[model samples]
Structure formats: C-alpha cells, structure tokens
Target: MELPGGLGGNDAPDGESLPELLRSWRNRAYPREVSETAAPRRRRSGLTQRELARLAGVSERWYGNLERGEPAEYSEGFLDRLSSALGLGEAERSALYLRAIGRPPTSAVAPGSAAAAGMDLTLQQFLDNQAPNPAFVTDLAWNVIGWNDPLREWFPWAAQQGNQMLWALLAPQARKQLVDWEGSWARPYLGQIRYARAQHPDDEALASLEREILARSAEARKMWNLREVHEHADGDLRRLRLPCHRGREVSVRIVALRLMRSDRLRVNVLMESGRAVGA
Candidate 1:
C-alpha cells in the first residue's frame, strides 16, 4: 500500500512490501540517547496527568489519548495543556502541532533515491533544512554514525550513547526520560529489532548488540522475549517530549529514512516545528 502523505513508495523489489521497508526504517530510527534526567522527572513533579489536564484546562481523556498516539480531535486547549505538562518549548510546541496533523515538520530524502553513490547533498540539504529538529544518519542496525548539531544540542547524550538498538534502552536515564516508556516505545522497539534479526541472522554486530542490551536491562529483556513482529514504518509516528536545554521540553518526531546507496543502513531523522530553520 502507498503510505499516507507519500510516505512509503511503491518501488521495492518484487514480493518486497512497504512493511519490509518500514522495518528497515525503524531500525534506522533508533533513539539518540536514553533520557538522562533524574528520577524526579518521572515522579510527575507531584502532579498527575489529570492535574496537568486541569492546569492546562483540557479534559483528562483528551490528554490521555494524546499520550497514546490515538486518533482524536486536537485543539489549542489540549496543546496548551500538553505544553505545560511536558514543559514543551516554543519549537517543541510547533512540532506537536505538525504531528497532530499526522505529518513530520520536515522532509527527508531517502538514501539512494538519487543516482549518486555517496551521501546526497540534496538529501543532506533536506535534512539541514529541518533546523532545530534532531535528525541523524544511521545504518540499518540503528548505528548513528552522523547527525546534525540540533540532534546533539537537543539530546546531548545521543553523541555519547552507544549506537545500537538495545543500549539506549538499557540506560537508566533514557528509560526514565521516555515520554511513553513501555507502550509507545519498548514494545515496538523490540519488535523492529526482531524484524531485523530475521533479515540478517548471521550479522554478528546486531547479534552482539542484542545480547548486550538484553543483559543490561530487565525491561528490554522482557520485551525481547515476546517474539512480536511489527513494521516500524507503517506511518507510525512517536511524539517524544524530552527535556532539552534548561529543562525545557522539546517535542520531536522520530521518522525513518530509507537510503538508496546502502540498503544495509538508513538514516533516522528527528524533526520539530516552530524553530528557526537550519542548524
């Protein structure tokens, strides 16, 4: 099926589906870093989602639905509540706005979408245009070898975080910082990992990364054993609200980029709205 908003295209090899491409995309969309905030962040700051709703002046149901990534009506009121509750900054607020419409704030050029053998400057320009959005270039196994500065500026730990699927999950700080740690994240993350495993069973690097993450994190270990399969690209977008500079929340859209050059790897781009363009 053609993806919504021209997402997945119809150019895969015979018998290869968009879901397969999505799985490849998900592997590329690995988290930059585990949240490194203190445990107090999870304590809700002595406030509940309900309280945040009340403070933001929106209904609890509306707020809850947003967190779940459910399809629902969104209004300015709800955005205000989410902004206040999640501590979203101006840029993040705009990102949330774009996601509410089911589209990323920025556009990405897939690798190999062009005729060149190296990184495409046009593609790089597209990524560059997505200023204030934390986008990165990665391999099929989710190894982030390069990224724009906004990515590191927004999530400093990303640069230092081990570039692997499970390592980011195993980190305690990252675990605490995830907006929807279990449901929106852990489950599908492992699902994609398994999907990749099926494609590259003999890939020693992936095998070793899986072992390390499962060993270090009980949460990751439990999720990995489920043996579930999910294609990461199926137009699924995760609205992640992380604390950025000065504890301000920066909302971002984590999307996948399928490269044309190396089918073995892809770039995961993080984007936000409402910030000055270019980074």
Candidate 2:
C-alpha cells in the first residue's frame, strides 16, 4: 500500500509537518550543550542528512526524501534504524512510526504515556496451570517469553534460547533432541514465521529473524526459498528425544492456542504419552 507522502504542504497532512518533526528530532539527537546563563543562546548542533542516512543504514537520497516529507516507501526496517540513529526513546519511536507509517510499530507499543510491559501477567498463570504437560508462551515474534517447569525439564534449551524458531533451526541441541529434525521441527517452525510474515509484512522483528535464519543455515534457506507457506506446528505429531529416557524418542503432539487477549501471543503445549515411540 502506497502511503500519501506529499511533503505536507498541500492539505491532508500539512506539508511541513513531518519535515519539521524529523528536523526537530535530528537537532535534538546532536544538541549543542550550553551553561545555565548560556542556555538562553542554546542552539542545535549540525547533523547533516548524509550523516543521518549513514547512521540509519539508508541512502542519503532516501533519507533526504523522508526529511523533506516527500513520497517514498518507508519500511519498518528503515523506520527502526532511523529511530535508533536519532536515539529516540519508546515514546519518541512510537510517535515517529505514527508519523511515518500512519501507525505505531508493533514492537514499540506505548499506550497513553508509558511503554508497554513485554508480557501479560495472565500468560504466566496459563502456563503454570498446564502442569505435567510441557507448555510455553511466545510473543508474535516467536520469542520465548514464558514456559512452565515441565517444559524446562523436557526441553532444557528453553531455559537458554530466547527465541523458539532460532533454537529449532540453529541450535545444535535441537538436532540431538528432535528426531527427523528437518521434516518435523525446522519446516513447521519456519512455516509459522512464513505465515506471520504474510499476515504482517511490516513486522520488523519477524523480518530480522527470517534474515538471520537465512544467513546462518543453508537448509533453512533452501526450504524458505521454496516459498512453501502453509506449515504450522499445531496438531502436528513430532518425535522428541527425551534425555531422561536414555535418548529414547517419544511421540509428542503440538497443541497451539492463541491467547484470548492477544492473537500475537500463543500458548504451545507439547502433549506426550508415557510410552516411547520406535526408532
């Protein structure tokens, strides 16, 4: 979707509005210090467009267009980098996104005045309540936010790996623990990310995760480049090699549920029978 980027003067967005806002933030990023008495004469230090573009990992021409409030595709990546370059806080980053993309970033959600707390308290309760079975919760980006003790006991890597997909695809422990690692774990987890990217094309964290996966694993890159989009772990049976059982494999079925409050947050339970499966 092409956003209206008419440099603010004509009427809809008030031409100079975005330009002035970006310029103000740029000045603040590199402000000239002044004494109490000298504060009266305090002024902005020079922060050229070229310098900002270099810092933001964008071309000078692209950033110049943004500074002038002209029409251009301002991606979430670009906006994130720009926010970082200008040293914007949560609130500032939210405001920048609102101005740039007509909506605040999915990651930088600030309700009213303060930044959002990463996870909901209720999610922990949900995880703990699901005892015996291995259960965990992940945010939209598939970052492992919360997990139950049973999960930590079964999938020990859950304690160290911050991201679920990253561990499934990149961690050496994953190959040792999951039988048929490629067909069972990697493909399904990547499928979830592929589906998410299709749904929210502007999610910066998701995009970054996909980029990292492609860069690190050739197998992942091949499957990803195949462009298959319908893989998901919910209801799929997977063979899990349990450490306590002398590396015996067990058939575990994945049950995924979206948290009632947020579709982005999911509760994943790995249900397994007491018996082990064949090799």
Candidate 3:
C-alpha cells in the first residue's frame, strides 16, 4: 500500500518527494564500498536512518517522522543540524531549508558596503585610532579578528585567545581578571551567545563554537542551557583587574559599535572611567 505523501509508490508528486530526495542524496553522498567478490545488496550502501539521526543529534523517532513527511513544525535549528550532518553545501542547504519551512534561511548579517571592503586594513585603522582606550573588533561569532596595542597591553589574554566567548567563558585567567566572573561576565556572555544562536541559526561556525564550549566547559554548558539572552548596551560599566597595573581594579565604560556596512563585525572599546582611586 502507498504511504501518505507518496511513500514507496510511483503515484508521488511530480517533484521528488522530500524523503526520497533526502534518501537519494544521502545514498549518493555517503556511498559505502562493498567487497568486489560479493554481490551488492539491493539497498543502497549509505548511512542508515539511525546513523543519520545520531549524527544529527536527534532522536531516531523524530528523524523517522521527518523522513515520513509527517506534518510537524521543523525548527531552523533542527534543519541546520540535519544540513550539517548531511554535509549539505550552501545551495543544498538553502533548498532543504526552503522545502522544510516554505521559506529560505534568514541571515541577520547585512551586506558589506565599499567601506567594509579591505577588512584587514579598515579594521586595523579603526583599532589603531582608538588609542588609550582599549579597543578590539570581533566577528559575529565573537572571534577576536583585530585589536589595538592598548587592548593587547591591557588584556594580554585577549591577544592570545582567538575567540572572545571562549576566552570569557572558559579561560582560567579570565576568572582572575574579571570581578564577579560568573555574575558579570560569563552569564552575560553566554546570554549573548544564546541570542546570537537564535539570530543566526544557519551559522555553522557559531554552532560549532558553541558545541566546543559546551563540550569543554561545564560552566558554559550550564549557562548555555539556561536559554538566557542579552543585548549589550553602550556605555555599560565593566570592572576588571589589570595585571599590568599590579592588580589594580578599574571600572571602564563599555562602548560597543556595530559596523553599519557589515552586520558581522563590531568594535568593542573600554574607556577608563576617571574616578578617584578606591573612591
């Protein structure tokens, strides 16, 4: 008997059934070689549904429902995981998302303008000019792509670490440098990451970084699962103990500027608040 939405039947729609399309793509993409002497089995040599489900980090039943074309809301996060598991390229990924959601994947990132071109030179000058105030730039994933000399001098760890999220959430030195690490820095940073994840569900790099943090740090994992979100505001206060000044604690005004030309790049500057010492 034919199943719903043309399962195991020729009476399927003119367009390829989503299940069949996924199966065919999976079979072709992950072909397994059999011994030459032995006759190949009737079934295609590819990952089993269970294996695919495992790779996608979904329950086997949910994956089965998806293949069966069951009527259910497929979230972007689920689609992203499935896409990553199947190793879908941009085109295939977009198609899968469209088919599943009846719309294309949305990116929070905006198109970069001419001024955003030559990112290295532009970012270098941007940082260099913010002298005295520690300044740095990060990609959407919070990777420290560029920084100024003051930033390097103020926070040596920032120069050493590639990812700001990882540095704040996982670095041992961060706990020492930031006062109230969990309350002030780690939790808020994790919340920002959660917000970013929601904003850019299709960003595989962000997903991978989150996974790495979850795997490596128990604190980050706990904070991540909380599902909190935060948007950093300009002129916020951040307290840090600068090692260069012999453990002198300073409060700085945070200035976060999003580059209009590029949605992915942002400049973070910390200006020292001219307050009396220990006042």
lDDT (10s digit) by residue, model 2, range 1-279: 222452221223333366887888788776322111223444457456765765554457879998887865576655765665576776667667767767767764422111232465566776777777788877676656578888887765454324677667876667887899988778777887899999889866778778867766898998887777764578788888867557587888788887566777777888786522111
Residue pairs whose backbone atoms clash in candidate 1: 34-174, 35-173, 35-174, 111-259, 111-260, 112-260, 112-261, 140-265
Model 3 lDDT at residue 217? 85
lDDT of 1 by residue, 1-279 (tens): 333444432332333332342233223432222234424333312345454443333446755566555665554323433443344444444445444554432213221112222445665676666666767665555654455677776655445322435334654445655667777777887888788888889864456556656655787778878888776643455555556545545555566767765666566666453443354
Per-model C-alpha lDDT, please? Answer: 0.51, 0.66, 0.66
Query: Each model's TM-score, in the order given?
Result: 0.51, 0.57, 0.56
User: How many residue pairs clash (N, CA or C atoms closer than 3 angstroms) in each of the candidate models, in the order given?
Assistant: 8, 3, 0
Residue 37 displacement in candidate 2 (angstroms): 63
Model 3 TM-score on a 0 to 1 scale:
0.56
Index of the highest-TM-score prediction: 2
The lowest-lDDT stretch of 10 consecutive residues in candidate 1 is 107-116
Scored against the true structure, residue 43 in model 1 reaches a CA lDDT of 35
